[model samples]
Target: MLIGEVARRSGVSARMLRHYDSLGLVRPTGRTVGGYREYSAEDMRRILCVEGLRSLGLSLRQIGRALEDPACTPSALVGDLIRWAEDRLEREQELLERLRTVDASAPSGWQGVLRIVELMHGLNSPSAARRQQAVLAPAEDVRVPTELLAGAVLAESDPNVAGALRWALARAGSDAVASVVSGAYSENVDIRRRAVLAIAEMSGDEATAVLADALRDSDPTVRRHAALASGTRGVTAAVPTLVGMVVEGTNDVEAAEVLGRLSLDPECADRIMAALVDELAAHSADSAVRIRLTQALVEMSGTIAQGVLGQLAHDGDRAVALIASASLRPVRVVGLPDDESCDDAGRRHPSQVLRR
Candidate 1:
């Protein structure tokens, strides 16, 4: 067949066919009287093969090697092709996400677009300081989108940068809750942990609802963070986890403080006191645990917790007895810098006395 006929039938442009011939990928098998290139049946098959491989994202050199090298096997080359294709796909997906974030911002003009682009670049920067600055940068005119801040919060690993991102998300308020909540359910433990932490800083019923769900997370860290945040928001469901933290000595002081605050509600007070008493009974053999619980009781109203403190004051453990007895006393001031009375009674904050 003539090159023109082959081009017409095969859909390969004549220019491309000539280029393929020069590369020896598919040379014409013969020539006509006018010296035009002529393709044989075998040449047509070779042209089809090159196009087939090209469709699989093969480079021209790779196609030539694949067609000409007898020792080159399809298995290894196809595997390499698969990896390259995957890399390209990942790049495209990342680009798509960036575009979506920018579009979601609804930039007013090219200047707005450039500002967002710069912010995104900073957020994705390798340097943690740059990422932090990206989040903390002044944006009086151009408000950073909540989605962008939430995304950065979930992905940030550095402690300082992660905190800054969470702060930014908090400032974004409930608008960022959904994005951060999605991260709360992420398969990655770190991502889930970050998600809960970010959501914990957010306010509003929506954030509180997300935290309530997060309390059931399998990861203990996620649950602890959720419990703390939820408890502060008056979600009574956090009471159990907060009590457990006291027992486990994981942020026990803060947990106890939250529990004490929760106890302000008369009904919640009964439940809080009951949970604390139960923990005290459960850990009767552990002096350190009992001591911590004793300190936690001080946060409760003196009227409700006085009876329990009286009984604990006479407990077998000397340290528990001293702490409880001190708690029972009506010191002129508690938790004050110049309250020498607390020092005179050898009383200290639970956090100061317990390492665990």
Candidate 2:
């Protein structure tokens, strides 16, 4: 077949076919009297093979090596091709996400688009400081999209940068809640942890609801963060996890403070007190555990906690007795007369009692 006929039948442009011939990938063996290029049957098969390999993302050079080199193995070359394809796919995916974030920002013009792009580049920068500034210092007229902030919050590993991202997301409001919530359920534990922390800083029914759902996360870290945030939001379901934190000594101080605040509710007070008392009984064998529980009681309000403190004041463990006795003493307000105790300060709130 002449080059024209081959190009027509095979759909390979004549110019490309001539280029392929020059590269020796598919040189026709025949020629007409006019000296035009002609292709044999074998040459057509080679052309088809080259196109087939090209479809798999092979470079022209790699295709030549693949077809001409007897020692060339398909396994290694195919593996490299797979890896290159995956890399390309990942880059494309990142580009798509960046474009989506930009579109979501609803930029007013090219300047707005440029600003968003600049912010994205900063957020993805290797320097934590730049990422933080990207979140903290958005352009004057452009508000960083909530989705962009949420994405940064999920992927940020540096504590400072993550905190900044979370702060930005909080300022951006509940619009980012869905995006952050998806990270809360991520299969990656680190992502889930970051998600919960970021969502914890956010306020709104959506954020609170996501936090409540996160309370059941299999990862203890995720559950603890969700519990701390949820408890403060008046989600009584977090009481058990808050108590567990006290038992495990994980952020136990903050947990106890939250528990104290929760106990201010007349209905919840009894339950919170009961859970604490139960933990005290369960951990009686460990004086250290008992002492931590003893201190946690100070956060509780009303006479019930005082009674528990009274009993612990006389307990066998001297350390526990000391902590309990000290807690039982009336906490004098800094500015009030020595005679005026916290009780005389107009029934201080449980959280206030903890501060004292």
Candidate 3:
């Protein structure tokens, strides 16, 4: 078959077929009387093979070798081709993500577009300092898109950079809340922790709700952070976890302080006092646990806790009794209504005299 016929039948352009000939990938097996190149049946098979390898993303040089080199095995060449295609796909995917992020920002001009591009590059920089600077630099003047910051914050590993990114995300406000919440459900433990941390800094009921949901996370650290943040936000759902933190002595001080704040309301005060007292009773056999619980009671406000403290003062555990007695002294419940009083009457005199 002549080159034109082969081009017509194979869909490989004549010029490309001639180029293949020049590269020795598919040489014409014969020539006509007019010196026109003619391809034999074997040449047609070779042409088909070249097109087949090219379809697999092989370079022209690679295709030439696959067709000509006896040592270049098909398995090895195909394996390299697969890797090369994967690398290209990965790079293209990254580019697509960048474009999508830029599009999401809806930049006002080329300058705005350039700013986002630079910010993205900085966030992904291998240098931790560069990532840190990228997160911090936006504070001065650059306005990074909240979505970008939300994504970066989840993936950030450096403590300083992660903190700065969370600050930036917080400053971005509720606009990034969806992204942060999405991260809260991520399979990655670190991402979930970061998501809760980011949400903790954010205000609004949505952020609070996200933290509330995170309180049940399988990861203890995630649950602990979420519980503390939620308690600070006055989510009543955090009560159980906050109470547990006191018993476990993990961030027990902050947990107690947050519980105290949550107890400012009359209703919450009674519930919190009950929780602490219950935990105190449950851990009665463990002196160290009892001591932490006894100290945690100091964070609670209102006379409801004073009665519990009074009873605890005479407990079987000497350390518990000493700590509770000390806690009972000079104690005043700040938010109790005048009508409200401790459940035990005998303890009332100490509460009354203490209230005075």
**Per-prediction TM-score:** 0.88, 0.86, 0.86
Candidate-wise lDDT, in order: 0.87, 0.88, 0.84
Over 1-356, each residue of candidate 1 has an lDDT whose tens digit, in order, gives: 99889999789999999999888889999998999998999999988988899999998999998877898899988999999999999999999988987898788888788888999999989999999998888874776788888878888889999999888888875577887788988899999999989888887888888899998999999999999999988889999999889888999999989988888898999999999999899999998889889988988874779999999889999999898888766544444554343455677544443211
Question: Best candidate, TM-score-wise?
Answer: 1
Show pairs that collide, candidate 3: none
Cα displacement (angstroms), candidate 2, residue 86, comes to: 2.6
* Model 2 worst lDDT window (10 residues): 347-356
lDDT of model number 1: 0.87
Error of 1 at 249 (Å): 1.1
* lDDT winner: 2
TM-score of 1: 0.88
RMSD to truth, every model = 5.7, 3.9, 6.7
Residue 344, candidate 1: C-alpha displacement in angstroms:
28
